[model samples]
Target: MALTIMIADDHPAVLYGLRRLLENAPRSRFVIADAVEGGQALLRSLRGRDCDLALVDWYMPPERGPSGRELLARLRTTFPQTTLVVMTASQQPAVLAASLAAGATGLYDKRECSSQLPRILYQAAQGRLCVSPSLEIVLERHYLTRYHWGQENHQALTPREREVMRLIAAGYTGRETAAQLKRSEKTISRQRRSALDKLGLNPDSVPTLAPG
Candidate 1:
C-alpha cells in the first residue's frame, strides 16, 4: 500500500519540489496526501485529515507557528499515529539530538533530500530510526570531541549510565530522561554523575552534561 504523506515547509519551492519528487519517482511507495506551507497550515491539515506520515522542515517562519523541536513535540503529542520525519539544514549535534528527543522518527539533511529522502521515509515507515549519513557523522564527531574518552574510561560506563548519558547528550532534560528510562530522578542524577566521573569531564563545562 502506498504510504500517505503530508509535507510542510515555509517555502513554496520546497513544497513544490518535494511534491514533484514524490509524485514523479518511479515505483514510489508514497503518495502526497497534502502539501502545505508553514507549521500552522500543517497542523490545520492534520486536524482535518489523517495521513501515514508527515515530513516537515525544521525551521519555519516564527509567525507561521512553532518550528524545530517544539513543532515536532506538538505533532507527536497531537498525532501519535502519524510517523514524523524532520528535514533540516542544521549541522549542529544538539539540534539533531533534540529532534530525536522531541519524537522525530527520521532525520534527513535538506541538502541530500533529492536523492536520500525516499529511502529515509521508507525506513521510518517501517518503524526504524533513520538518520542521514552526513548528520550521523556530525553527531559522532561532536560526541567524540566533547567527551574525549579513553578506551578504558568508555568501557567503564554501565548500561544504565550509558543510556542516561546518551539521552542527556541528546538534549533530554534529567526529568525527561529519567521518565523515559523508567527510573527515579535521583537515580538518573547519580548515574549521570558517575558517568561524568568516569569520563573525567567537568559537568559545568559541558552545559547539559551536568545533572539537574
Candidate 2:
C-alpha cells in the first residue's frame, strides 16, 4: 500500500515546497491526503480517513493552534495509529525536548530536504522512531542532563513575561518585539523593564544571567 502522508504548516511557501517534494517521489510509494494547520489536521484525521504518518509543525502562530507540547499530547490520544513527526526551524533545546515528550514518533528540522525525508518516512511507516540527525546531540544532552519540562516556572515569569524574554533574547528591538508580540511598543518596553527589574539587572543592560 502507498503510504499516505499529511503535512501541517502555516507558511504557504513551505506547504508548497513540501508538496512539491513529496510529489516528486515515486508515486507508487506515497499519497498526500491532507495539508492544514494543527487543529484542522487533527479534525481531518478524525474524520476516519486512514493515514500512515503526519508531519506536524512545531510552532504555528496564534493560540489554539497546536504547537509545543500540547500538540504532541493531543496527537497521542487522538490518533494513536498515525505516527507523528515534528518539523521545526527552531533548534531551541526546550522546544525539541517538549516536542518529543508530547509523543512525537519522529522529529526533523525543516531544513532537511526530500532526499532525507523519504528514508525517515519509510522508517516511520515501518513503526520505527525517526529523530533528526541535527538534533541528536541536543536531545542526547537533554536526556543525560535530566532536563525537566515546565521548569520555566522556577523563574516565576508569567507567560507574557516569558514572551518578552524570548523576544529580547532573540535581539529584537523594542519596537520589533512589540510588533511580534502584538502589543504597544510602550507595553513591551514596560514588560522588558519589569523583567529586567525582577532579574536584578538594569533594564537598560543586556542579558548576562540565566533566568531566575
Candidate 3:
C-alpha cells in the first residue's frame, strides 16, 4: 500500500514542488493525501482523514494558530498515529530539542532540501527517524549538554567553582566555606561570583539572606 502524505506548507509553490518530488520518486509508493494551508489547518484536516506522514513547516501565521515548537507539540498530542517530519530551515538547538520532545519523526532542513529531502522521506516511509546532518549535530550537542547538566551537575563549573557551589549548597556560610577549604573569606566571595557566572546565575537573583 502506498503511504499517504500531506504537505502542510504556507506557500503553494513549495507544496507543489514537494508533492512532485514525492510523487515522482522512481521506486517509491506514496500518494498525496492533501496540501494543507499550514499547521492549524492540518490539525483540522486530520479530523476527516488519516495520513501516514505529514511534512510540516515550522512557522504559520494568523492570530488563532500556533507555530514552530507549539504546533509540533499539538500535532504529536492530537495526532499520535501520524509520523510528522518537520520541514524547516531552523537550526536552533532549542527548537530542535523541542521538536524531538514533541514527537517529530524527522527534521528536514529546507536549506538542504533538494539533496536531503528525498532520503528523509524514504527513511520516514520505512519507519525510521531521519534528520538533516546539521540539525543532527545540533541536537546531539543539545542532548549531551543537558545530560551533563542533569547527570553530573556542575559540569559547566570549574573545579574551584564547583567546590564553592557545593559548600554553599550544603548550607555553609562564606566564612565557614573559606575555613573549610583553607581559603581567605575574600577569596570565597570572588569564587562565588565566578561560580555564578559559569552556572548562569545572576547576582541579582541571589538571596540577600544567603550565607555571608
Best by lDDT: 1
Overall local distance difference test of candidate 2: 0.70
Instruction: Flag regions of model 1 displaced more than 4 Å.
Output: 144-212
Error of 2 at 181 (Å): 35
TM-score: the better of candidates 2 and 3 = 3
Candidate lDDT scores, in order, read 0.82, 0.70, 0.74
Highest TM-score, which number?
1
Angstrom error at residue 94, model 1: 0.8
Clash totals for all models, in order?
A: 0, 0, 0
Q: Write the per-residue lDDT of candidate 2 for residues 1-212, one digit (tens) a residue.
A: 78888888888788888888887866447788977866555555656877788888888875436665776677778778888888887877668766766777677878755577777788877877676777766555443332332133327666887798887788777777777889887787777767655543433335432221
TM of each candidate vs. truth? 0.69, 0.63, 0.65
Off by over 4 Å in 2: 26-28, 145-212
Worst 10 residues of 2 by lDDT: 145-154
* Count: clashes, candidate 3: 0
lDDT of 1 by residue, 1-212 (tens): 89999999999998999998988787898889899888888888899677889998998998998888789888999999999999999987667777777778889999874778888999998898888889877755545443332123657899999999889878888778878999988898889888877866556535473345
